[model samples]
Target: MKLRKPVIWFGIAMIMVMVVTGVVMFMEKVNVFATGTALSDNGWKAHFSEPLAKEAITNGYVYVTDRDGEKVGAELVLTDKGRTLQVEGLQPGNYTLRMEQKAVNSQFKSLKKKKVDFIVYDSIESISSAADLKLYFERAKDMQSVSVSEDMAGSSEKATMESAKAESSDAVGGGDHSSTNIQVEGVDESDMVKTDGDYVYSVFGGTSVKVIDIRNPKKMKVAAEIKPNDDYYPTQLFLHDDLLIVLGDKMVRYPKRSASQAEIMPMNSLTTIRLYNIEKPEKPVLIREIGVEGYLKSARKTDGMLYLVTNVHPYLWAMEEIEGDALRPRIFDSNEKEKEFMDFKDISILPGAIDPSYSVIAAIDLTSPKTSQLETKGFLGSSDQMYMTKDHLYLTALKYETSTNSRGAEIMIWNPGRADTEIFKFKLDGTNVEFHRSAELGGTILNQFSMDEYKGNFRVVMTEGNMWDERNPSKNHLYILNENMELTGSVKGLAKGERIYSARFMGDKAYMVTFRETDPLFVIDVADPVNPTVLGELKIPGFSNYLHPLDENHLIGFGYETSAQKNPSGGEPLILTKGMKISLFDVTDFHNPEEKFTEIIGGRGTYSPLQYDHKALLQHKKKNLFGFPVSIYEEGEKEFEVDFTGAGALVYEITPDRGIVLKGDLVQKKASGQQYEEWETQVQRLVYSGESLFTLSMDEVKSYSLDSFKEISTLKMK
Candidate 1:
């Protein structure tokens, strides 16, 4: 009897011990690993001294450490220069010496909390080097190992705006360069999800939108796809709780002129703004239609307010009918330029140009007034441009009514609330032939022509090849507008305007990145907006598409940082460099934003200053420069299934950090053989509500669950 009792006790004790051990290990999610022999003795693989390759390595996550405590704690990543600590979005300026202690040890198992103290050197010199790598967070909710976050920034909220601006300030935005890591809380892989390229069919025009529910990322299902009304063609879709507002061109019953124009040719007179009641997302109902006199092309939403700042839509590319066809110019005496003339410039002038149409600022107050407010949107120039800062909306406008071409476009500020909308306008005026030209660059425009606001001033930056007598920088301009929307000051004649493309604002300075030539980044101290001085320049090879400012001293540049002078596309020896890299710097000394730690974690994609949860969606290497392409990776599966159009996207899990998951195929259809085949069909846009990834391509909206990345439901337009 005594032996039986002892044996039973021992068995119970063994089971209890096993349970406790499992609990401990499960709680200790973070495991420190030693330097694997897989890593080459040279540290970096042979060919990747370039910034992009280095960034990919840094992002590759050499080591994964967890903060064993609350939501906040230090997560140290292995860098060539020991362990660098970042806290509260700031680097602690701490360092270490030849600190090779237990290269990979689970000493963290003893950590009562994630907070641990490591050997530190406060000196800046011993800090080794900064991360010269590009960073981006691929938010994948299905895969926790990726640690990407979503629900960080909302386009329509002020808090979202401020934080989004801050994200831009981070090296991601090129404002603050001292910060390196963009902690994404989710996983972004080419697989892990199945984009069963099958979608339902519909032929509805623009009145269609895909409805999604984003609370539960894992089990999300497509509730419905609705086509509110037939006549209204939606141009853009913005989410508002249950309602999905569609921005489109509508025909006014009283305004017969526009209706008549449309009757003449369906493409002539287009409507501006319209609203749909999406309370039943699956079955969208038309609440009311709001149409302005003119047409609208592109649109964006931030907060509950919808800004359908009107612009011209390009549908006119018709040639003037020739009375008699002849081949020769001199032989026919018809004064012909070319027998087969491909005229793209004149296309904008025909029926597509916005020179004749004016825009309106319609604040669709979804929260307050049932009746939407409308005002003359007094801002101009053309399409593919326009930005809002503070309460003022800056746009490119022609100097006066006399000009015809884009060179007439300059910077202007307008207030939607104000009755007299034209607050101020800035331009560099000169004579072209016999006409006075007042435009962004005084004559012709330059690269990625854009406007940005720093402190209180607005600066215009772009790429210009050659201008007038100058060959270096085509043109760059800076204009300061006060609270009254009046130009308080201005500056022109940029030194490196020709090569630059993307730009961002820091405290009192701005950074401009170049695309062509010796693409170096230039810093401009705009303390004196009228006479802004160039701080210094950081040169990297290839083009600089976007700049994410981590701090005043460091900036993360995305886009290919080529190894050779000529690009691989130009018959040059293909150098497999880092597609995405993070470049750190000591920007406290902005005289020159010094390159510090540059780690290439992966490839580089877009310069979207995106946030979800708390982490930032770092940088992604773009497979294609022009279009949005998504690659899929199955969970626990290695390798990617790259799909161009069916590039599924899910950014619904917005939270304290930048974490969200985007997966699935782009060309989503429900019919057999209707799968996403790049050669057969093209895909449009994608939307997400946690689990169900709703992809709206062409007339179809397909849904996929986050748990299995499988297509669940599909809605075709009516």
Candidate 2:
């Protein structure tokens, strides 16, 4: 009996030891399972619990197959210390990542899991129906965990103006005159000031459009003023033949019922265009008015058709109580005599667009403004920069995705986990506009100048990463896409650690400037649609913000001259801007570009509107003359301080033989104890009519003789 009892206890003890050993072995076996998947610029990443064996990662052990189990040819790379398996070169579709048990070492296992379903897509998917859009909003609300009311706010409009071109006339004062400096030749943009050689039409004090007769330079006088109602304030003007088009903002109020039953009214802003018959300079008659709900994004006139883009953000959160037309954008036409909401059939969603906003585009037949109809369409998305050709219009939007880290903290990051630009293209035919394909590039565009369309291909320059962030320094890239928005060629990883300051695309080549400690101007050859290469590079001491073509082989750069100073923080030297710089670059040699001439003005605190607004510059190509308004400041006795010197307009004659020569200086004298610029006296624009040059400011307009540089007349505007 004693022997039986002892054997029972011994068996129980053995069982316990076996259980403990099994548990230890299982814990050390290194079982792996996919935690999640992420998309990057290079490829798709399948994250696992533990690092994998390098030799076991191969097509035989790890591969991707389509939804039907057909194996896809892709390059497999083990990254993140074998914790991530990268699958590249796969087209957009649903796929399954199959990792065989053999992919793990003999001492490891895969938790008996063989496949992980995933998707490889680069484009955005459109919302299928109203139900789908509601689901989208619900998902967005769930993810954000915030009230939509917090996202609602007032939006401001941007002023983008252009110059005017007049036909050659035989009148005494009608000679070859300069128009608004523009990017495209045939595309006309609206500006605050426009001229038709004999008359200058300008927006004065944002209240009225003034028609100044410039036929007699010494007797320049205001001939007429078109003043609108208090609700409409003019911002820009465009002159087409005998028609004067004025663009401004109009305020509309919506009555909101309060909790106490009181009516509270909120103002909403809309873009309005007023067309006037200016056959007689003295008496202007209003022809018609066109209005669209939202803030004006941009406008372009070509082939006697006007295209307007506006961004409309309605009270989407009000969908909880209100529905239908109340949340949709509206359009007003004088012919209709009433405002109408946009049709649902005319509204489409951009792929991956999460913002509850609409980009409304309207086409007006300016050729017959009196009886023409308005055709407009709305897209649910947001656009930052716009570029257009005679046949196509391109809009770019920056999209960000939300991701969670190891700590479960949500972080907002650019789409694809990099700085990406989502671009949409539209085909423009006369007064008809249609949406084309869209694409996603791995960088952010600088401005409208960063994009261009050539013979059959579209090219763009983008800057990736932040220049101030050392961990992921900036790098520039240039991409070429086909008419269908398919990737054709690219020059990636250019100018590492520097961002693009300026980019300009010529016929067969592209000029780009990137800056950090020094400016590196790159000349890229893009003639071959499938293989673009860097032709040359020039490193200089400053950067260029705007680039203008002087001729076929020459270019002009406008920006700031910078110098390196010792960094008190002790890493890289600090870049100290010295003065406003003008450089003429010679690229006659495709393999070697040279800065032929350079001119710097003032020191420390010198600025010109031409640096930010290209229309502020005056270019007389016939005379090889260029001028802009500048506010000059000099370095003070204390460190990091400057003293205001003066403000005025300066003109220079730049030629290949003579280089850069000062032609005229019309600086306004600073009053005693004037330590800052006077807004009223600051020159804002320079225009030339025949042999006379006019400088316009808020207070007055002054005319100078182009031949003698003598002041002829001054007309008070205020």
Candidate 3:
């Protein structure tokens, strides 16, 4: 009997041990690895076997850390009824996801701490098929929804203002005359006016392109007028050899509807290029017409080939109904019978770009215009600015990042009050443009001049943060990248609290101007692509909007002069613009640059188109002359008011020995009591052929002798 009692007690002890083991095993199964951990677009997700404690899914208990154990900036959300943890804003890097004890259900108290080591990819993979493309857009659409509401409130007004600014800003040349003020010596950019030494072609009255014979400036006459159909409006011109190319916008209307349907469909816009045989200037012959679907962004001609870039934003939200090519950009060539949509194989995704727009690039072989040798490719992204050389083309797109607050809620910010620029490079070979690679910079580019390619190295200048916001004052930076678009070296955090106003890259040097209360011209040595350093800085009381190289040792700064004024509201002193300022800088000693001479025009409201458009300035290098059109305004009796004095083209002889000497002024006589500029008489461009200079306005073309500054003759067009 005693032996039986001992055996029964042993069996009971064994049974209790078995029960405990089973319970522990079941608890282990209800952990975070129930499904699996996976990466997502800009984030990652962890699946749990059982629901987690709402309070435990926080920055304290559940967080992401770098390899060095530093907490990473991310947003955590409890999704799928608290069974899933979503962490977002985690860039591509090695990370360790830590889930402390008690992060899961409290019932499983024996749970130990969990740590997951993984890598976050860039998620910038290319689309391989139509399904992949659709999925990519679907995800993009969902992501954009979070911030669309906030963006919509101000988008329309902002877009209108930008459109107006773009329309107002824009500019040609050649003899012993001025060529279009181009960035590259050999590469030519399209402008509103173009000259071939003997004749000047210009877009007049925004309606037609007029060919003016400049062989005899005093007797200059309109040789011919090339007018397109009413559907097209000419904007810019390009002259190569005996071929004249006219670029404009054409309105495409929908098919006519029945009488019962009173509503009309919206019209679409296209960029049209018309090539003319100008062998006989008296009667130009239109040889070919090419139409690309979008608004013209930029165009360049080099190595006997013409390249055109346009941005197209399709109705992607209607992709479900409009299938295939209907959602793609199309191109029409006069050589072909019908227009065709770009093939899917030719459309590739832009790395790091999220915009659902297409940047279409078309290349035309001017060497054989009649043969119709044209190549067009579309990239799924949006381009704000374009810079090109003889061998490569570069495009820039701005990208914004979504951030989280202290509470881990996603908030719409301007990429934390700043934007990043993504640069894409394309190889150019005759009429072929191939995608090479891409890279990113830390700020937004001011304009096309902000980028340059030199000696197989690409140099860029950018401005970060908002200049108007004191809390986040802007800072400038210079980045150098290799041919593959990889960062080779950088000069960062330059000109703190100021923004870049103008930038220019010379052979082995780069000049940048940043402005706030004063202007600082930074001269940087870029001879060593890996270690660029600032050689010198010149601080003055004004800013330069454009920088032109007078020679290897001198630079011309064109901008506005300013004065500090006592603020009526009593904060920071108000900076009041005084007048147009032109500065001649001598960089003979790289380490000691000097503003050799300065010239200031009218005061207060004085303005000139040359401030915004580089092509507006005519550079007669041989004669040491620089000239631009200006509208003069001086401060009046009332505060913040100015009276217009006159409008004219001013020519100055700028030299190191003799500063800036005003050679002549062609001011149009204003009517009695005139207080504003008259558009008809406002000079728009200045060009010189042989010894005669020509001034073009909306109403007439006038010629003046370079020797005496006397008006020779005028040809009225209006």
Candidate 4:
């Protein structure tokens, strides 16, 4: 009897020990640590001592909630080898993170805390000077060993305006000529097409800049060509008076010694800016060549000053041993033996941003007779988009909270896919560019049109969440800020489940397009800057990827045509996209907006570059001419497959009275070698010079009479 009693006591003791050990194992070893104080575009991450199971971090257990106790939708991505939890989709607000007593680790044990608290501040801190930039780089270097978050890796690789003679009657009013679509009245936007009232400058075959003399349409020929050296290829061009600016990249491949033999190593990308005096059209004199270590992100020309932005990814891994001068970007004057790197003092960065990439802004004064000198400023971040006004220049970059090695702090972070935008402003004072102010916003912008400066208030449109996500999907937002880039008023949670496809700001009104299954064109009233409101929305069959303003009351949209089909076993209809779509929207009555006209071209896989690149669109309001390069594709015998048919320029006459009328199709005669190939003779641009219209293809430049649409001449590009 005594032995039985002792056995029971021993079993009871073992049970007690097991219960205590299990309790300890269930307890969370690490507290949730967050990096930034606010929730940013790249949502902040929550770091636990040990990675919890992905299934455990759910809306029911681990999530943020509003003051009303409503759960704020967020995307939780397990990163750092399942050790860190990345949280996205949380907007700026005070919220409680509720982790139930049952919330467990990877082993399915409960967390120690029943609930945790955190506040998503309204804004993020921005850097001030070069010293701040240095510190940011220092921190990014220290975090080299940390794994890059998947959410951060998924953030898109960070992949502008008019001039006055642009508003002339021949340019805008009631003229029979077409011009490059521009943003501002006086600022000239660089394009594949630039007409100086007599000649056209077009990039040919992505190899040379061809000057076409349209003075005599019957004999229009390539007057001159500037073929860059083998190392550099010009992609975009800007013309001011007699000076033509060519912007491109210079890639240098050099031999590097390996363990056994010498190997050719490709150097870092270098942005190449070449200034040429084209006063003598037949011969362009290379006046200056500026080579900076970076890829040209964007550039703008205002008041004879060219503001160029370049994003340079330094050899950060070997930054310590790199030559100090090599760390800076270099500029070489024409005929000068010495190359000058942008001074260290000229580089300044936004504070708190952890981007290792350097954004260099260089301002060149075309008005100055001394073309050798250019003022440069550098920022330590990644630039995705840029917007420039007559007085100010805005460079926007996105930094995800989950990006690897962005900061030096040892504390694990809570950054998910949420991103924060850094807006760096520079004052355009005549010929000099001066750094103005830097600010931060939460969310990712679409493009240059996503940002606008109205009445001293800066307005922007951003998208949150994953576009392909079906569970917690994407949404759009419109934010208004003062000159300092501080958020004043915002209208968020728009088009929930849809991502922004296009945005356009005209004066006090902004038009935005979002898409998933259907396209919702939202008209926002920002006249009150402080209280921006969504006036109305027009749902359409397809989405617009680029929006162009026809007037104060009308907008022209270019995108794709989509149709939805129900599955045999129904859930959500499968959306099938096809063709190229153009829409004319009338917002004359804010309350009753309508798609006045819509035109779908081709079938299945038909595509237009203009849908993805605004530069491909050529418009002339006065001439009622609108055209873009399109490639026709037909559906094949197999489902979801297509075959190329033809490529050309589709010109349309757009007018309020007549609507959209097909002017004519302009196509280039195929090259002699590949004449039968469908890809041959693909027209890329259309330019109007006087009464003649010119269509540019890789193989040739064809001219047509504006009135008759008859081929006037064909100049072989080669």
Identify the candidate with maximal TM-score.
2
**After superposition, which runs of candidate 1 have C-alpha atoms over 4 Å from their true positions?**
1-207, 214-220, 228-231, 250-266, 297-304, 312-357, 376-384, 398-449, 454-456, 462-473, 481-492, 549-554, 563-588, 594-718
Error at 413, model 4, angstroms: 7.8
TM-score: which is higher, 2 or 4?
2
Candidate 1 local lDDT, residue 549: 45
Candidate 3, residues 416-449: lDDT per residue as tens digits? 2345577888999888889877775667887888
Cα displacement (Å) at residue 140, model 3: 3.8
- What does candidate 1's lDDT look like per residue over 1-718, in tens digits? 2579889999999999999888777543221111110111111110000112123223432222222322222333333223221222212322111112223134333321121222211211110111200000011111112111111111110111111122232212222111122211111111101121222112224455444443344344455555545565555444455554555555432212343343443233344343446554456566554543345533334345454445532122221211111100010001222322111111111111113223333344555324544322322124334455323444443211111111322112111111011112222111000101112222221211245555555555432223222322245555555433345565555654343455656657766654334466667777776677777877765544545544344554444444544554775344433243334444566676655554332233312222111122322222100112232221222222322222233322211122122332332233444333442123333433323444444544455654455777654433
Off by over 4 Å in 3: 1-138, 146-175, 254-265, 316-322, 402-416
Displacement of residue 636 (Cα, Å) in model 2 is: 1.7
TM-score of candidate 4 against the unseen true structure: 0.79
Please report how far candidate 2 places residue 611 from its true position, in Å: 0.6
Lowest summed lDDT across 10 adjacent residues in model 4 is found at 160-169
lDDT of each: 0.34, 0.75, 0.75, 0.68
Please provide, for model 4 over 585-614, each residue's C-alpha lDDT reduced to its tens digit, 9 standing for 90 to 100: 899998778999888887888877777676
Q: What lDDT does candidate 3 reach at residue 67?
A: 78
RMSD of 2: 7.8
lDDT of 1 at 465: 27
Q: Ten residues in a row with the worst lDDT in model 1?
A: 132-141
